[model samples]
Target: MKNIDVKSFGAVLLALTTSHCLAGEPADAGEGTVFRSLFGDTLERDYGITVSGLVDAGFSRNNNSSQRDRNSGQTNAPVAGLADENFELATMHLFIDKALKTNFVPRVTPLPGPAPSEASFGFTLEAAYGRNAQQARTYGWDMHLGINSPGDDNPDKARRDKQNFLAIPNFAGTAYLPYAGGFTVMAGVFGSGLGYEIPPNIRAARNPFASRSYAFMTESGAVSGVLLGKRLISNDSMLLGAELGVIQGQGNLRDNNDSKAVLGALRWRTPDMQTWIDYEFLVGDSQNDSTGDIQTPRGRLISRDGQFKQQHSLNGWHRFDQKWSIGGEMVYGHQEGDGKASTIDIVTGPGFDQAHWWGANMVLTYQQRKNLSLSVRAEHFDDPDGYVLFPSSTARGAFNAVTAGVRYDVNKYLTLRPELRYDWFDGQDSARPFGAGDARNQLTGTIEALVYF
Candidate 1:
């Protein structure tokens, strides 16, 4: 709700840049020696330090695609051209960890090696620091800091600014859970647990079907207060878990209002099957409103009188065998706003809810080997408010798409993926396409690479 002066904001950006540069140096030094230590059995005695990263560079040709040129150019149908491209950066990450043995802490009495079992505190100070290249280009630095608690088992836990698709226990130190286990309390900024694609914050590319074309839910942001509980029904087959939280509503950053949200989920898993259903309810000032008043640089922005939004999702995954798997996700959400009648045709009618939308995705994958895999995915989206595209329209549009791709494990530390996609639009006559002119069909190709250590 408050805006920082340009100078103060610039100072914060500078500090972040310096921090990222410093973090990258140490990890880069540790990368070379990590492999030697692991293979020589020295890792057991020494801390573990590893480095990994990826670089993906490739050429793509689009058919029936349109392009806009900044320089002098001639208009053409499905214009096509070729040139060297560096669409995405391949990264190499370095990690360093020190493992303090289980008995390092002293027990109440005293036992062997380090301390007594009962009194001993089994813990490890796992600190992670890294810098990314994208940060260098955009923010002048990519600095990260992470610390994990002792005996923490969930590796997929959420992280600050990191987005995750499934709702699971939080292992990342950033999560604001009151307690770690059984009737836990958590609060902080965490990813939305709906949607099939990886949370958008950490995504390497855009999610084709997200409501906002360039906005990934992961990057949507969060500021939350939560309470969670989990009950294990069976050793491995059933589990019931629930989470309730009040989100800050002002996107992912700090703000002064109590825009609240509640979420709950139930999960079941076996060797061959897994399924989950989640519900989310959001009530508060519209994302466009904060502090009961909408303030903008130019003047006071009007707040919609009865604006509210809600979303729901269901997801499941099944492993048919060691080599094949199938999964699907469905999500729907609606936004309603009340305001004075508007003469503008694009605006929802008088006191009308402006946006109603729903969509879903399904994917099937096959692992040909340890180093290779293939996947096919389909997605559909409908936006009645025309929120996804500019020139918000009164006529709703629907979009459907299909994508196929292959992932190759270039090595233990690197992976490369190449994909091709096609998209189609329903009600072509009712809405304009993404590019200029009247086109309804589109195609795209991409190659991505990932590296981890």
Candidate 2:
């Protein structure tokens, strides 16, 4: 072994990694990947572009599958993710980033995150494909992409494929001005920056849970516009941050209404670095589009002219010990439009009165070992007026969920999350949205693998 060529072996490893990674997830993979190991020097050194990606897939089993058809697919109705039964061809993401000109790839990167005092300019372009892409699409902007169905012409109308979900979740440029602590301005298509969890779907999973909560599933998607953020106070111990933006409305890629939406956030990181709280909101007109393009078989399902929509949230977390931590989030959202019974998650047309919905969630996690951690979450969302959430025909009114999962780092480049989740509907007895649209409750067990390179 001492006589072997080290450099030649690395090249072989690069090629083998590329082929195996593309084909499927690796069981015990090496730290160095294809692009990062091969072009990590050239791309980052020459053009300042860092390329990274991850593939997250999972298999979920629903207890109610017996009451449903195998072809219909098992589902945890009302939850955006975890909707599929058996194997889920989850998010496959890629990122092309130029963040902080001076910082690029190296053999070993230390924990010193983005420096506060230094000014910088950068950009990010991310492409994602999977079930989550249906929620990540920039609304009107990417019509042909991220649709829920297969090709326009297919015998099985219920069939879906990765080809339908080629989505650009984020595309934006940024500039950091080194004045009064630091000011950052970002524009183009990016996130609303309002929620506790986001489907960044690049580099890695932004949230700990493999399956998202009802609050997160009902929250708005990416927006098109500009955002301005500043570090009001910054130090080694504490950091106070705030941001504001004008967008084309949450989920709406282009301007559907004559009016635009306003979104912002105020965050506080305590001196101990073990606790933080954030208050974020989005308020404005998101309706006014009558175009048939956005319609669904359920009916005109989203946005209405002159109806103003708003959502507000308060969330925080505190750590009592290195291994034990607790976090929670509260949300209140409503539209100044007539209430309506939704056949799907989004309802556009008018109904009885104004709509109102709210939700709360709590998460507790334990770091059992250096390479493994355990998490459990309890959440409830109320769509009393039959608005905000609608996963199945009978899945209306309110939603409740309990989830427990563990994350195991198999290696630097591989992660595995096996989760158990239970959900129930609190609506009409006559309508059942679970058990393949036949039962009132559902249990799903899932194992998700995240492979990064």
Report the number of clashing residue pairs per model.
18, 4
lDDT of 1 by residue, 90-180 (tens): 2223323332222111100001232212311111111112111211110001111112221012222321222111111111122112133
How accurate locally, in lDDT, is each candidate? 0.38, 0.65
What lDDT does model 2 reach?
A: 0.65
Please give the range of 10 consecutive residues that has the lowest summed lDDT in model 1: 103-112
Each candidate structure's TM-score, on Cα atoms with residue i matched to residue i, is 0.59, 0.82
**Tens digit of per-residue lDDT, candidate 2, span 1-453:** 212343664454355445655657455443335576565568777777877777666667778875345444325455556556655656668888886532211101111235456777888788877655655666556645425445322313433332325678678887777676556777888766566776753333336777888778656667778888765665676767778888877766656556788888887776565787888898986454565444232122354445677899888888889799888889998767545533123443435346678999999989898779899999998877666664333244677899999888765566788988888878844666666567778778888777667
Work out how many backbone clashes candidate 2 has. Answer: 4
